[model samples]
Target: MKKVFIILLFVAVSAFAANPDDLIGEKFIDVYGKDEKGKIVKLSDVAGKGKPVVVVYWAIGDVDTYKVLPEINKIGKKYKDKIILIAPLLSVSDDKEVKEAKKLLHFDFPVWLAGSDSIKAYSIEKVDVPYILFIDKDGTIRNIMVTARDLKKIEENIKNLIK
Candidate 1:
């Protein structure tokens, strides 16, 4: 039993140390979204210099998730031209409910509809509703915020990257 416990702890620690920064500088998956003008936009085009993007893959009914929109926008404002908000509004649960949630965000940022493959490529499996990913200008996902408590730390990390 003691040996088993020791192995379990080692596994947990290893998993925790699985390099949170692993996704940086990777080629982006071809994620797609419709522009406000009803045109499809792909993630490839968003990759550019002088900009680090925040990609939020959020579902509709997640009430707490929606609250972060404004705060994310604040970060966007801080970096100004250096920040891109690519929040893909998905109907992962309530298809009809996302529109209102989208409206509530009042975001001037580009909102897209992510396909299942894109979601999976970014590891969007958890039921946390509003999981956020941060990608630098080179299209590498620098970090994934596992909880809302991680937001401030995520912002600070982005600020450092932007500079």
Candidate 2:
């Protein structure tokens, strides 16, 4: 029983230490998923490269997700030359739905099919829609927002980070 407990404790500790949040200051996990075009897209491909990236995790048909898109769209256009915006719709595994969402949302940014693997890689907990992460040009996550209540603040941060 003592040996079994020690093994279980070691396993639990390793899992806990592997949480994706640990990648925040280090590097953004290169999650590969399909885009609206059904092409495999990697997060690292869109991030870094002397531009800050804003990644928003949303769900299709969620009102809150729809609500946040306009602001994100505006920001994307305003920072078109300096920053990159990406929206990864959660729980959406089909290319057809991704294409439909791209048209419906009229997003300026790319919409990706964020699968279960992406979710686990982000270490997302029971969070609300429009979970946003601001990654620096160096591919490090600088800010994270679980809610969209403070749009002005986030936009300011984005502008500052991109500069």
Candidate 3:
């Protein structure tokens, strides 16, 4: 029992140490996922480009995802040329599910099917829904918002990142 307790304690510590919040101000890690057309898309492909990238990590049936994605899509449209927006569906593997979710969500942005690998890279395996990462042109994560639904504040962050 003592040995089991020690192992559990170590696992808890490791998980906390790998928190995604620690990624703020750090160089964004490159992760690969499938685009709508089943083509592989790398985070590096969109990020480090000449525009700020907004990565929204969402799931299929999360209420917060449903609530915030439409608003985020508006921002994506408003700054379509100035910013790169990508919504990566966590834990979703099937392409048909992605298409259905995209239609139901009504988000106009690019939706990628982020599998276990991408989710693990982002350290969001146990994190809440609607996890947003704002990456600047240099591929550095500038800001992170977890479970945030405030559209104005989100837009403000995008504008700041653009400038």
Best of the candidates, TM-score:
3
lDDT of 1: 0.66
Give one digit per residue, the lDDT tens place, for model 1 in 57-100. 76655666667776777777777667777777665433234456
What value of lDDT does candidate 2 attain over all alpha carbons?
0.78
Stretch of 10 with least lDDT, candidate 2: 17-26
Estimate, for each residue in 1-163, the C-alpha lDDT of model 2 and write its tens digit. Answer: 9999999999988787544446557777788777877788888887877788988888887787777787788878888888888888786468777767767877768888777777777766545667788899988888777756567976987887777
The Cα local distance difference test for each model comes to 0.66, 0.78, 0.85
Model 3 lDDT tens row, 35-124: 989899889988987789999999888888888898888888999888999998885458788878778888878888886776667777
Once fitted onto the true fold, the runs of candidate 2 whose alpha carbons sit more than 4 angstroms away are 1-23
**Candidate 1 pairs with clashing backbones:** 25-140
Clashes of each: 1, 0, 0
Please state the error at residue 32 of candidate 1 in Å: 1.8
Error of 3 at 34 (Å): 0.6
Question: Sort by TM-score, best first: what order?
Answer: 3, 2, 1
Q: At residue 27, what lDDT does model 2 achieve?
A: 72
